[model samples]
Target: EAAIGIDDSFYRVGGDSISAIRLLVLCREAGFELRISDLNNTSTIRSQAARALSDDVISAPGTTTQYAPFDSFDEETVQRLKDNVVPGIGLSWDSISDVAPATPLQRGLISETLRSDGGDAYVTWKITSFGSDMDAERLRRSLVQLVGSRSIMRTRFALDPILGVVQVVLKEQVGEELVPAVEYCTSASEVKARATAVSQDQRWGRPQTSPLHIQIISAQGEATSMVWFSHHALHDGWSFSVMEQEWRQLYDADGEKPISTIGVDVPFTNVSRYLAGRDNEDDLNFWKTYLADAEPVRLASGSTSGPPPPDANAQKTITHTTKCDLSSVARACAVPPSTVFLFALATALGLFADSDDISFGLILSGRTLPVDDIARVIGPCINTAICRVRLQQTQSAATALQQLQADLDEINERG
Candidate 1:
């Protein structure tokens, strides 16, 4: 029925991966074993219907007699349903209780906060574009609406009087200055210097404030650069990317887009709730055994100590970028480009550390849970996994790559 006339394209009419999953659930309940891959490849109703009836369709694994129907809802709708939700029933469309568990990552952040000496960690992204029409006032309006609509954008911390643990709190309304903080500089160098200063000097306003901020630099009137600053406690790399994409969409549309389209997001508060209730005994055991005898990473300077205590009042960062044929490396290693990049990164760090035995933390997306529309739950939603790779003096590069691949797969599967 959603197809209207069979020729309609599912995606052209606002159908997305979430809707496709919902359709799959509905069809499965009706005794149709449809392949999700087939649905993704073909957008029209006729093709999907035909594919559904054909032998090419494969049944979804782990069949059950009962399946939730709202599983088909887009990320936004699912998240909206979670806000002020009732407890106990779990992932339903009807109104329910609103208690959520704090996630493991949130717990760690809370621990850091309790220590009181925790330094700030913020992710910064700067975009410079030319020959474009971007209205500052319109962008400001979009930013304001964006902050008001998402709970994570306005989330803050408070001490739970009874438990003594820091509690995540969502405000009913946030009225932060939405206009991008403007800076004027005569040259590009000054612009960069001023932006860095803002990123370093700005804080998330002492516990009871939003962790996200933005600044717009109008440099020389020929180039406009926007710097997005977000505290790591509030967002991860994935969340920042999502926000940037939406920001561009809003700027391009002159803020005419509906809040429903641009602003529906999973609240970090819910993530904290869900994480607080996870059972990770097995995962803990695995890590303990795997890295029982691993030594601390050593640098070429023969110092294994971490970077000098971060200057609380200043920001220091060093970034280097060089491009190469990553796909070629991926092909040689028989792994995806992402894995290849990690392998290369570990190797480079191994050289810097002056040791063949390397161990470092890898960030996971934390979306592989039982929660509905987990991908849309926008907060930190980031978990760290330990990556350990042992290199041999005479081992072939291909062999080392294969070993790294095996280690990564094990960590992922167990985590």
Candidate 2:
């Protein structure tokens, strides 16, 4: 056994969940039975190396992949993916006076929409036999403590005419009691199946209002929980997926206190600062031209009613899902899933609008902070951009894809 360099400080070399899976596969190929949790416990490269050496596990060198860090152009792409985050001005609010004084992050969330329709945001989980050694109260306390310590689970709002300022409010537990709901197995297959179903249902049934709600219900004697959130406005699909992942991690930790460094370092407040510093004249001009002389299409088929008024507060929604094997498409295009998804969405929106004048909003991950160490903070880290696709007489999907890639390249380059 050889002694490898062991650094006292832990550092993550930018490996996400997918990368962690790849690492696990590589370790297995090298005859080492390593799990994803192993990577979490040994976050630093040096630490992981030491673990492999200590176990006398001769593993092959893992392939390294570098990801582009967050930046302005990437910010624009993220804004396009999100539904809110208008340019130049802060969230377009109907009545700021009626809005209660909220934390900066909460204000940003509320201001994006017109009205505040307080709704329920609760999630549920079922615990099978609380492992003869498991204490229900201890688990509950651990969950509460985890929620209190994490800002992503907290509420963020703004106050007064303070354009860029934000305030954050931690969410409190409304009730704590393990109730019987449904029974499921504790096997990995069963747990993942249940979690995926819950995730899908929540994704499809998501609402569009404010005062975000989350609920978790655990069935008696079942190690599964049904988790649900009130609306999609407070958080996007990706956000919910992330929350589920972290919750599972915490649960597996068995009420053991988590490391303080596991918390999110970059809050959405920095996004506000980024927007405030930029001259949004171009973004405003793009939107002005995009919406000019355009009318909102009636959402449902066979509706005779005209489009709703153009008030910022007026509520409107259109849901359309494009059926395509995204993973296969990404492989063919040699681009990340995000790039492919955004391109398809942008193209579909442009085609549906019946004009080249189309602009969509997206959310960005703003982790480039001088003081922040982790980049997983919640709040609205999003930006907006116009994906102007000129329709030709006979445009093929390949051509559209090429054009989309070029547009993304330009947007990213400029950012």
Q: Which sections of candidate 1 miss by over 4 Å?
A: 1-102, 107-133, 161-172, 175-205, 213-229, 253-260, 300-326, 341-356, 367-371, 392-400, 413-415
Off by over 4 Å in 2: 1-135, 156-158, 161-165, 169-234, 260-265, 282-375, 382-386, 393-400, 409-415
RMSD of each: 12.2, 16.0
True-vs-predicted CA distance for residue 13, candidate 2, Å: 22
lDDT against true structure, model 2: 0.42
Candidate 2 C-alpha error for residue 142, in Å: 3.1
Per-residue C-alpha lDDT of model 1 across residues 202-321, encoded as one tens digit per residue: 463333344556666656544455666555566776677776677666666664744646755555655554454456798788889889888778653544567755564565688998
TM-score against native, each model = 0.57, 0.44
What is candidate 2's lDDT per residue for 100-152, written digit by digit as tens? 12233334444543343432232222222233343333445555555554444
TM-score: model 2 vs. ground truth: 0.44
CA lDDT, every model vs. true structure: 0.55, 0.42
Give the C-alpha lDDT of model 1.
Answer: 0.55
